[model samples]
Target: MPENFAYPVGLRLQGRRVVVLGAGQVAQRRLPALIAAGADILLVSPSATPSVEAMADAGELRWERRRYRSGDFEGAWYALITTDDPEANAAASAEAEARRVWCVRSDDADAASAWTPATGRSEGVTVAVLTGQDPRRSAAVRDAVVEGLRDGSLAAPHRRSRTPGVALVGGGPGDPDLITVRGRRLLAEADVVIADRLGPRDLLDELPPHVEVIDAAKIPYGRFMAQEAINNALIEHARAGKAVVRLKGGDPFVFGRGMEEAQALAEAGIACTVVPGISSSISVPGAAGIPVTHRGVAHEFTVVSGHVAPEDPASLVDWSALARLRGTLVLLMAVEKIGRIAEALMAHGRDAGTPVAVVQEGTTAAQRRVDATLGTVAETVAAEGVRPPAVIVIGDVVAVGA
Candidate 1:
């Protein structure tokens, strides 16, 4: 965090009285932290925003539900004066001064006896940055430090102990930044990472030099790693007391075969944590300026895997039923069989001219959208040289908010 002369220190306010003079935006913003700190909050405001009122209704704070009164800070260890009326704010600050209680004046920071530092916590560590003058800069610095710590960029080179287990992390739609904070933190602590070709490939570049990365790519109609081999690798490393991360693309459970890995870990008696990611089913369409379900345009949406052709005996999807729905359809892993899928949809009951939009490599630098209809989407995709890792959107909602 950035340096300052504010002499930052954290106050232990658990079960202690803390007075707040207003319940407007500032109070609404600051009250939650106080409540989380286990402070006994006394809110003196005639009215509050719906959010603040709900907090009061839930008994999170003691709300007087009236204008500020003299001696409101009599039993308070800390006071926050934020009323709309300058006179009320000044009076509360003066009372707090006479009582020798520390106070923060939101209306006039210069007159306040205390300043609130931008604060954040990660991995059992509390970080506070105080810039007395630039609250925005303080917040930015605090965020940077916390992010670095969580991503292991600032982690110590050696640790007294290491956590041995396996984590199934959903890397999220090919964007490194889209990975969850918890997932990133786990990756930073990992000794080995088993990654997929379709996962957030960029994140692999950020791993430390000592971290081992294994390509567990399951390329379509190409080179791949057998499921048994991948499972064995995970169990083997974990049994050797190494921290392992199985990084997959999109949601681990959304056709990513995450449960299979989890079950494998369970049978091996290895601890496994599964972290979900943003699936392309909805996010991909939104990235390409399409809403899967727009009011009146689409009342519902269905997601299906098109890896198997409609005529294939292994296919479980009911093409006829899907065609009868007057909503949206999202297909994943269907680029290889889009022609057959489109034919089945049109042959059943769906309109041949239904609007369609295919987003390739959604949420990445190479993302591109190809527009067509159910009647010609296959041809359009082929003519445009579209490839796998694309999201297919079919419905009137495709054009509702385009």
Candidate 2:
């Protein structure tokens, strides 16, 4: 192969035979893309990495537990030679060439008949970048383009038929960047987005003008709409033949009241899907340099909603049992009632001097951390003017990274 002479093209491998000779790191890296392309993959190797083995166990591809043979590429349209043995790679490449099958060699690019580009997919468009033989340059450029597409900096207008359904998408902690790729893609396809106060607002702003945006926080009933009304809205919009995305903050199951809406959709016979997000309970403390569970420091961690005081009859949490555990405690939605919660914990045998850290608006530009003892956290929170949507971590792990 000469410098910059290889022609770049996308192969439609769907239902086509593709041979992979080797289950090493290189094969592991390339197998996913081949699978995504719907290739009829035949993987040949004596042994494989755990991930590759898992794929085989899951029936994602056919695994032949043996060395590559001379006629392995007999009926293959494409082949990948990733074996570390140069002789083996050469043998596989020779077989592929004899069979008129395009082959990619990981050990030697000059010997390969094809080159796999650094690829990314966004809004049904696959972006593949090739910088001659420079893999590093290709990967860097691919990442930049994908980031632009994800952040709405690069617009690729896709015409999607609006499906009548409700999707509960978790927008992640606070940063728009933290949202999952699937969540973002669903947002792009949504006809109506019912968003809560805590989700990534910047993403909502990026939606097209024709996309109806409903503020779940200000939905007429009061500061927040009644749960029944929210359910009604989801069912109503879906019945109107619109794709409704119920966007919330953090993991939908993590104190987000997502199951209620899911049940409502199920009862109303409307289709619904849930996309999990990075919960603030763990991520917020991590952003503030606090580990909920540290080796030899805290072996366990518990996340609890502290909306109601421990002494309240409606509260289901067992404060006494929580105090007895030698683990880290992460509290959410407890800013208003921190005093009673802290006092209840201490009264139930937890150390008064236990370290506590309150992280406000975590994973965002407005993030702030206030550290105090369990006995003084309430006063510290007040003096610091810490608001809601904060995560409070209690235990020795809070001071491990201090």
Candidate 3:
């Protein structure tokens, strides 16, 4: 085999046949990329990992459930020889070579004619790096390039055909990196982004110049008007044949009022897609080193919106029932009314000395955590100047991780 003679080219594998000689770790690592490229994969193996088996069961690929045979590469445009048996790999490679199909060998790359480069995708661009058989170097370089592309450090404009519709994307706990891949991809292709205050703000700077960025907080008038205007904006832009993204912080359905916006869009006869996000209710506490549910410590975890005090007529949460549960309690948007909420819990039979942790602006650089007890949490929050966009965790699990 030559030292550095591998010609790199992106294969248009969509609707093309590809064969894998194994279903082990190597195949597991390679299958996802092949699947993403829309390749029709034929996997041959006696057994496979649960993940691979799940993919096959889901009809994403064809599984042979047997050992690789010599003529397995008959109609394959590309082949991967990933069997643990060196003889089987060599046999599969030879067959692929005879059939003029490029094959990659995971067991022995030096003996194979083709090599799989470290690859990463950002926006619409796929970056593949090959450092003369050095997988570590290739992966590092690929990661750096992808990071640059994601953080706006690398300026690559992705021009995509905009599908006119509304997508409610959960940006995930205040961190740009925490957003789901689907949400990020939708954001890249968005023509108009109606973003909330809690959404990842740094992502707005990465959007293309032609993309319209609307700050939901500054939507004229007050909070009610802002929400109504956001709903109207989504309908108006999508109706005008532009791809509109309603980017919110945390899970759209978890107190984000995403359902209301979705309903409004549906009522206006607009197509709406909701991309679920990592909710702050759980993620914030986790980021602060507090598990919402711990074995033996907490059997269950309940997430509740504390935007309204328990004493308020508008509040619907059963404070007494929540207090009776021997589990974890995760409260969101409760900083302003923590005193009343804590008081209500204690009065309703919850322990006054229950461990409490408040995580503010979690999963972000400005993130901070303040620890207290049920009796002292409200005063501690006031003294610490904890803000509204914080998560309050009350239960034994708060100390389990500590």
Best by TM-score: 1
Candidate 1: regions farther than 4 A off? 1-4, 156-160, 218-225
- After TM-score superposition, the amount by which residue 299's alpha carbon in candidate 1 deviates from its true location, in angstroms, is 1.5
Q: Candidate order by TM-score, highest to lowest?
A: 1, 2, 3
| Cand. 2 TM to true fold | 0.83
**Better candidate by TM-score, 2 or 3:** 2
Itemize residue pairs with steric clashes in candidate 1.
none
lDDT per residue for candidate 2 within 1-402, as digits (tens), equals 767777778899999999999998999999999998899999999999999999999888999999988888988999999988888998888888788899999999988889999999875678899887899999999998987776555666556664589999999999998999889878887899999999999899888889999998666665545988899889999999998899999989999999999999999999999999999999999999999999999999999999999989999999999999999999999999999999999999999999999999999999999999999999999999999989999999999889
Model 1, 33-73: lDDT tens digits are 99999999999999999999999999999999899889889
Lowest-scoring 10 consecutive residues by lDDT in candidate 2?
150-159
lDDT of 3 by residue, 1-402 (tens): 777778889999999999998898988999999998899999999999999999999999999999978789999999988888888888888898899999898878877888999999875678999987789999999999997776546666556565689999999999999998788877887889999999999888888999999998877745557678888888989999998999999999999999999999989999999999999988888888998888789889999989899989999999999999999999988888899999999999999999999999999999999999999998999899988788999999988878
lDDT of 3: 0.90
- Write down the worst ten-residue block by lDDT for model 3: 151-160
Who wins the lDDT comparison?
2
Query: What lDDT does candidate 1 reach at residue 305?
Result: 97
